[model samples]
Target chain A: MVEIIVCFKHVVDESELKVDRANNKINFEGAKTKISDDDKNAIEEAVRLKEKNGGTVIGLCLGKADARKSVKEALAMGCDKARLLSDPAFQDGDAIRTAYVLSQAIKRIGKYDIIITATGTTDVYSGIVGPALAEFLEIPQATFVSKVALAGDKVTLDRLMEEGVETVECDLPLLIAVAREINQPRFPTLIQIMSAGKKEVVEWKASDLGIEASTVGKNGSLVQVTSTQVPKSARKKILFEGSASESSERLADALLKEGVVN
Target chain B: MRFLVYSEDIDVELELVSAALKSQGSQVSIALVGDEDPKENSKTLSVAGVSSIFQIQDPALKDFLAEPVTSALEQISLEAKPDFVLIGATKRGKEVAPKLAVRLKLGCITDAQNLRFEDGHATADRVVWGGNATSTVSSKSGAVITIAPKANERAAGSSQPDVRVLNFETKTRSSKVVGKKAKDSAEVDIKNAQAVVSAGRGFKKKEDLILLNDLAGILHAAIGASRPLTSDLGWMPESRQVGLSGSTVKPKLYVAVGISGQIQHLTGMRDSKLIVAINNDKNAPIFQECDYGVVGDLYQVVPALTKALRAKTGR
Candidate 1:
């Protein structure tokens, strides 16, 4: 049986977020959070592989204390067991620190054939965590994977690149960062959602993982946020309000005047 | 002060970093990593403010597997100990930068559009929340940063620089590339197109893309799409998708049809010189960001716009 660990993050839904123009900060008050969008696909892929190959699917998440809900959500989606690493010290941890903490938790879990993660998070979207985590685990990583096939002890993946697709082959004990195009995630049924409460969720503090407090959170972060501001629009927003034909004529005229077209 | 810039090829990003370093009175050296010979590229790089070049070659590097590349760069950084390490924020760079940062135990900044030195640290500004916000960040010490493509103008210099070949041994890794295939639609280079005609979920069917194709033909533009049209419906090739996971384009003119302007899609095209959106939904988010917006069905609006453009240009 194959044992796989999938990692996800709980992120504030950006569509519901409001920016404070005067202070240049994001207003997350009263905002609803969800499992980061792409992580759903990661969890779904893990569950599907378990169904086919008959293995255990472990859900792992590292975030603030509020992220326990994300572990429940993952359980409802078919994760056999879930683990959460929550601490106040992790509040300001950046990608590098988060990857280190997650790698430590994976190590504590003991046995796993593969680690799956989303390509990037929804809010920050830096797309660096999985690769960095692979480094910490001393495992080979295949990122932006669009397709996956299991063959005995090796896994083959079709990786999406900027130019085209490349087929890559790697052995077990590998990490894969899957793109959103890889699979359609499943929605939990009402029964599954209810039963998710019965499943056990193990919560561990940063210290419980044997990581020193100074090396697992903001204190270990290398980068610092200096300031944040709304980007200014550089173009004049001109709307051509009318019938399709009328608007099309006006748009063409504007483009002509600007010499964007002949 | 000294700065190190590395890329698979000698591109505009190297010149941009070189110029920034030169303006700061810092020495700049470049490391070009790939299978290609550096003799010809050295000529152009030398004139772009590079004082020396290190050509690191290995057959395994041709595919840019993260393990070997990161190992090679780690070895190079150990010796150079540059004040900063800059890499182009391409697909490969995004994967390599973080691993290298972990190996070197340095702070890493990805997708940096602007960089500055302040208070004994390297500060970088990058877009967040798609393109809605920009965050400026700084590291406590020397950092690994990936420069956003086309973030600055290419620099020019007069002197020819010396080139050195570095023979670093690459460690063996488990992953290997078995095959490679060019996308069928690889010829449509949306990244460099002057004008782009893009479609969205408002496209009712795959065949409906013909209307967008016709409009692109009239405008001499490339055809692009929102994620669904490519990833979900396969109406267009993956190469034509424009979003956070797809290609980021900065064309001179971008005409969006039926795109509701999700933050992900906006990040890919919001930097265009001019934006025109045509959608039936008046409340679509695209209306707010576009220079010109028409609240009408793309089925009707796109053909009318195409005809209008043809008549105006007598094409």
Candidate 2:
């Protein structure tokens, strides 16, 4: 039986993300937590792949336990099993450490045919973890996947490219990181929600995974962020008080005055 | 203390990162991750005075996919153990750097405009919220820093990748590299271009961009615009927009036309070598910041400037 492990992160809401102008730190104060949009798409993709091809879907949630709920969301989405990896040490971790913990979890979960993930989290908008995990797992990966199908042991898929889309065939047990063009995300059903609620959330810590602290979290990190504050935004609201045509003309006039239209 | 400026085997990126780090007095090293032969990548990194270049080449790395690329870094970091690792804030770097940092258990500053090390620690200038604010952030612990794409303005100079080969057994999974797709930029590309001609909302419509493009073609410059040009109006893609929400650009000559120089937009193009502004409003922020200012209507003035430049440069 083919087993697939999906890595996902719960990030701050992108629509509500705020920056404190006093300092350049992103404001999570007004922001609520959300599954990284890409990860969410990945979760949906994994579920669809499993439902169609018949495989076990394992959800790997590696972040603060607060993100444990995120795994429940995954279980609701169709994951057979979910693991929540959280420790105080893992808080505010950079992407590398997060991937490390996830890798350890994957290692522990052993014997997987595929690992599926989303391209990136919307907040930081960093799309690094997918390929990083593929390398860590020693597997080949395709990014920006659109259409995917499995025949026998090989899978055929399409990638959206600059010039033209290309089709490639790869053996199974590969990694896939989805870009924005994948299928629209699926909404959970009543049955899925109920199942997810009952689904197990396996918890693991750094010690549980036998990952050395010196190489696994902030202590092992090489770069240090000395400060995080929001940037100061220009608060001026230039309202052209006039009709659309008037507004357009006035705006044009303003642009000329500013030397922007000249 | 040294800085490892990581890049995908791109020529322009190699030069920009090395130049920026070297100017900052950090012994810069490069880890060019790709399927290409390591020798060439190493040569590209070395010309900029990079002490050494590390390349992890496997058939798995060709597409610049995030997973394998990031894992390679884990091995590189453990071995090189540089004080700080920098990645360009491009699409690939955006995906890979954070994951690489997570796996390596390192701190990272993404889209940072500036970097400074004191007492062997990294201080970074990270602009967030469309450059509405500037946050001077330093990781209390180790970090994996990502320089915002096109945000660095340093000129590319003599550099070669001082090559080293680190064969890492990448642990990859289900993901596969189907193919790569590049986005078309409506404005001029400033990623590594020598000169740029950019406009803000003041241009009003896509119809006004012809003169901008014409001038750019004559000047051998790339065209760019404020975020609204691409992000909201859909005239251009986000990849070409210059602002906090869009791509950041650094060029030798940045011509701001009909641009009011909002902070968010300016943050992306503020690092240009020479800035010239042509706007009707003398009070626009761009006027104060630009090296030269011309007050006029772009519709008429741009064509005139284009002709004048054509004659001056004999293009």
Candidate 3:
């Protein structure tokens, strides 16, 4: 049976959070967290692959202790088993360090045919963790995958690019970063949610993975957030009030006068 | 001081890096990786601010695979030890930067805008929570950074610089490109166009895009759409979708019709010079971000705008 692992992130739901303009900080206090929008598609794709090809789907998550909640959610979404890597040492870990921890967990989890990750996380959206993880695992990887097909031990991917689509082929044990366009993620039903509580969730701390604390978290992060601020727009924001045609005429006149249009 | 700018193609992002490096009084060297001839490629790429060009050619580097490109760049960096490296934040660049950072044991930042050198460290801003907020980050010395496309002004053309061909072999064994296909040409080039007319979910039917297309025609603007219009409804090609998952466009004018201004969509086009939003919902989030907003039915407002533009331009 094909063994597929889907790596996902539990992120602060940005819609529910409020930014404190005074300090330029996002207020996550009392904010709800959920699986990142793109990770949902990753989990759904893994589940679909398992259903079609007769495989076991395992969900992997790396975050704080709160990430245990994600393991249950992934189980509800049809993941057979889930693994969580939680430690205070993982807080604010950059992409490179995060990939290191994930690759280690994957190694501990044993053999796997394929690993899937979202193109990016909703909170950070750097889109670098998957590729970095692939590097750590020393495995082949395809990013921005919009379509996937598996046959035997070969995987075919249609990678999305700026100008065109490139179809790539790689052997099994491949990692793919799926874009949101791949598939519509399914929400779990009440029965699935209730049964998810019974599934196995293996938890691992930094020491359990044999990773040194100095190399796993903020101390290891190379990039530093010196400061943050709301982007100030310099637009004039001139409002034109009139009928549809009249407003259109006025807007056209303003644009022409500004030399934006001839 | 030395700076290295690497881009597979000679594009605005490369030019912007050249300009940025030049302004900082840093000697700039560009690295071009592909099958293109060094002498010929330098002719078009050795614009105003570049002092030298390093052309890296290998059959293995032909595809957009990140591993090979990262390996090649790593080899170059090991020898040159450039103080800074700037990569354009394309799909391939984002995949390669972190891996390169991990390999080189250097800091890396992605999607940096308004980058400047401060106290020997590279500082820049990036949007978070889609586009609702921005964060300013500074990287340690010897950091690899990916500059967002259209983030800076393009450098003016100047005399060609000297070209130096580099001997490097790509050692990528895992991934292989099977085939490649170009998107349809009828799709608008939002990246390069000066103006764009974008559609959103407010577009009830595929045929309604005609109104947007007509407006685009009058303004000679490219037609772009929000994600739902392209990915969900299939009303338009994916190439023209504007969002975090789609094309990031920075046109002189961006006219959004029926788009509710989701953060994902805003991140792609928020940098536009002038934004005009026409939506029936007065309380739509787009109104908060747009420079000019018209709260009315797109069916009526778009046609009127098209007519007004035609009357003024005599097109």
Best by DockQ: 1
Residue-level lDDT of model 1, residues B1-315, one tens digit each, is 677787664675555555456446777777767666667777777765667777777776778788888987886776667767888777788888899989989898888766887555788787776455788888988788887777766666656767778886867575999999876663258887999889998989988788887788877899899998888888887888888778889998999998999987998898898898998888787887898888898888888988998898999
Report residue B151 deviation for candidate 3 (angstroms): 2.7
Question: What tens digits encode model 3's per-residue C-alpha lDDT throughout A1-262?
Answer: 6899999999888777676767757776999999999999999999998998998999999988888888899999999999899999988877778889999899988889999999988887888789888888888889899898989998899988877888999998889999899999988999999999998888898898889999978888877777666666566666665689888888888889877889
* C-alpha lDDT (0 to 100) for residue B153 of candidate 3: 60
Residue A57 shift from truth in candidate 3, angstroms: 1.8
**lDDT (Cα, tens digit) per residue for candidate 2, span A172-197:** 77887775456667888988888787
Native contacts recovered by model 3: 0.72
TM-score of chain A by itself in each prediction: 0.96, 0.89, 0.94
The DockQ values of the predictions, listed in order, are 0.74, 0.18, 0.67
Runs of candidate 2 with Cα error greater than 4 angstroms are A17-31, A156-169, A212-220, A224-226, A234-237, B1-11, B14-24, B29-85, B93-109, B127-144, B154-315
Question: In model 1, what is the error at residue B247, expressed in angstroms?
Answer: 2.1
DockQ category of candidate 2 = incorrect
Error of 2 at B203 (Å): 19
lDDT of 1: 0.84
Angstrom error of the Cα, residue B245, model 1: value is 2.3
Q: lDDT of all the models against the reference?
A: 0.84, 0.67, 0.83
Collision pairs in model 1: none
